[model samples]
Target: MAAAAAMHISTEFINLKPNIWKKPDRASGSCCLGSDDISRKRKLPILLFDVMDTIVRDPFYHDVPAFFGMPMKELLECKHPMAWIEFEKGLIDEEELARKFFIDGRDFDLEGLKDCMRSGYSYLDGMQELLHTLAADDFEIHAFTNYPIWYNIIEDKLKLSAYLSWTFCSCISGKRKPDPDFYLEVVGHLGVEPCDCIFIDDRPTNVKCAIEIGMGGLCFQNAESLAKDLSHLGIDLSVPNI
Candidate 1:
């Protein structure tokens, strides 16, 4: 029954989807398609980057477990699975997450967790430089991520907006990746065909979903591999010598 309902939802979403490829006026604060408009002319893809683990280092796998004084295996076993997902979806608040974080409902230090996550929020190796190159070359970039409002913590720490707009966060958009609706929403909002965008993510599932929707996708293993993949698409990512 749940699967059938999800299918119905997906069907409705697709049926109602808008064509978002119209050119925008300059007043909307979007990067205008200027007189040269190569991104439009060549259909050079706007890069959509997944934030956690792709661009920013996610602490959940290492720091959080360490903070809890347990191995990742034990932390996964003890945690309430849906609590984190629900938090990412913006269906619950930090307070609710703290209350229900453990399967046994044991209270833990929420502030400490936040601190650990914050301390670990550095950009992954070479990702920052890659982003700078993309932005410098005027390839439009937007963060397409499934994270909660705590994304502000990352913003405050790393200033990622210097490279990509925090455009399609799940907390703001009410959708998570691997859900077709989320990818479709990005397409609809960007005023571009699915083919005009490429999504990069650390997770194969998320990349697959983007590809399934007719968007190009690259499974991001590391920054060097990513630059090579983008180069293969005929998008120039030649890093200028500093």
Candidate 2:
């Protein structure tokens, strides 16, 4: 596992298949770095960003309920509680989700729901430009989101890899944020200390967990506020001109 992880970092382009099949081992202090690699690791802090409400406009709250013609509370009562979590953890696929979406197993318009979700997937204000700026500065960035396989839909519409790789998504990693092991595994795979990373999420609990593990964390309110926070942490957000 360590060798595979090392090979992944050694490569010029990231291969998602290897990572999907063989995720990193649990972090026991460290895993993949050699002495030579350690010297080359330090530069800009690596950014791990949450998707959904942090970077993209999640439709679950408003658009989903609207599509179902119900309020959020009513939808919650009708939905299967663990089904979504299972999907995020990659334990289930879309077909399974559609089958088990409602608590009573009552069928709804699955395709219509998916279409609604896809249509509502868009970048939040200022995020696109902010991501571009971070990319321009050569800061390493990866999506550290707790989303399901439907993240591909987001990628298809937005092409988020233009700014950051969809690297640490729960669907691929089989782990979610606030799970300490997930964060540790990410650190292990990156071969970096917790202090070397900054995790950004809209959820305070998620950010809290990352900070508790020694990574710099910010509960994102907006891109402007996030930029200010990053600057305060001594991050260089200035984009270099071509």
Candidate 3:
């Protein structure tokens, strides 16, 4: 009961089962297909992808709670003691993060806790082919993620930086998404207009925010829908010929 009460639904802790969005019905919130013009030219200018749930399967929301022998619904509540948003902003390190990974901080195994947090990540199905095809077609693929430094492990493990020419992560940028400044800075650094970029994330709020900024954005659900969305944008990605 305590755990259930603690895990109230909010934007801060997304990826809750049936859909990741706070407003799943309005996927790609208030979408304007300005980039559909590119389908005519059969060209893609740039691609910006979110890391969690977009590129990789999101395990953090579930695995951590399970580690503590609780239901996944209790993740946010369980994580309340942890300064996760600050961690995402690179304002704190793993040591600081690990310190907060407990409802009661007695006998906390820091190394073991760190290992649990770092391990057990996997890719979203069909993402490999999507990235492969886009990279093959010479898309200026980049990752615009709001994640902590620990995500570096995922990137290195999967060679994400190799697939995407650039990795614009929050830990590196010292900012988190939905802040709008993060978007402005990333686009400014790339020397591209927001409309020139295509951003993808599993969260509708993030997608909506991106669209509001004049970029072509898709609220990602799964790889199939993602492929279909790109297809509409003139970039058809089939199952990779690999």
Candidate 4:
């Protein structure tokens, strides 16, 4: 009976048998199944992508120091993390942070720094292409990032705004990654079930959190590998080069 039911339903909608294993309580009017099963059954839309180190390379490690006329070693030695932390908490304005990092006592031109951050930041190869392809296919693409100051700048400069439907940043949202609250807030704000969204991040902890919230997640390595992996999930990746 279970096999028959499983075969009858569309795999895209739900890939399980209803009442084959166990029936739900009369009050609920639905069988109790795992989130994975429920998500497939419900057929939700939405793909959540992590920004830093996933779509774009680590900007701080590569973009910031070089643009600010400081060596990577010097920038790393400076206590920027605490400032960033405060910025993420909404205690400091993004513009203020940028001013502190790139303007105050910095010999580099502010406009040049902005330009470098905008255009010089390297994105994962084929990422823009893949995202465009996905969006063209009617998949809603959202970017979730920990970086607050440069999110809009990078997106605008890279021409990613066209492909990305919306962007969620910890700086703007006042929520950091790897925290269930951040993911929950996003899912709730988007009015989608956790299972309906597929989250990709470079960090395992974030992926684990997504999974725990009943969302599909993949740990990203590179654009080529991620494209291949998404293929298994029925997402085609024939986007044109950006």
Ranked candidates, highest lDDT first: 1, 2, 3, 4
Worst ten in a row by lDDT for model 2: 15-24
What lDDT tens digits, residue by residue, belong to model 3 across residues 88-142?
A: 7788887876666555543456666456656756778888888887888877888
TM-score of each: 0.81, 0.83, 0.77, 0.71
Tens-place lDDT per residue, model 1, 1-242, is: 01111222233333222223233443564534343453446445688999988998888777887999998778777888678778888999999999988999998999999999999899888888889988988778999998988999999999999998999998888778789999989988877667778788876767778877877878777788777777777675865331
Report model 2's TM-score to 2 decimal places.
0.83
Comparison by lDDT, 3 against 4, better one: 3
- Across 84-107, the per-residue lDDT of candidate 4 in tens digits comes to 665655668756655554323344
Clashing pairs in 4: 13-40, 14-40
Off by over 4 Å in 2: 1-37, 238-242
What are the Cα lDDT values of the candidates? 0.77, 0.77, 0.68, 0.64
Best by TM-score: 2
- The reply for model 3, stretches above 4 Å from the true place, is 1-44, 73-75, 103-107
Counting only residues 3 or more apart in sequence or on different chains, how many pairs clash (N, Cα, C under 3 Å) in candidate 2? Answer: 0
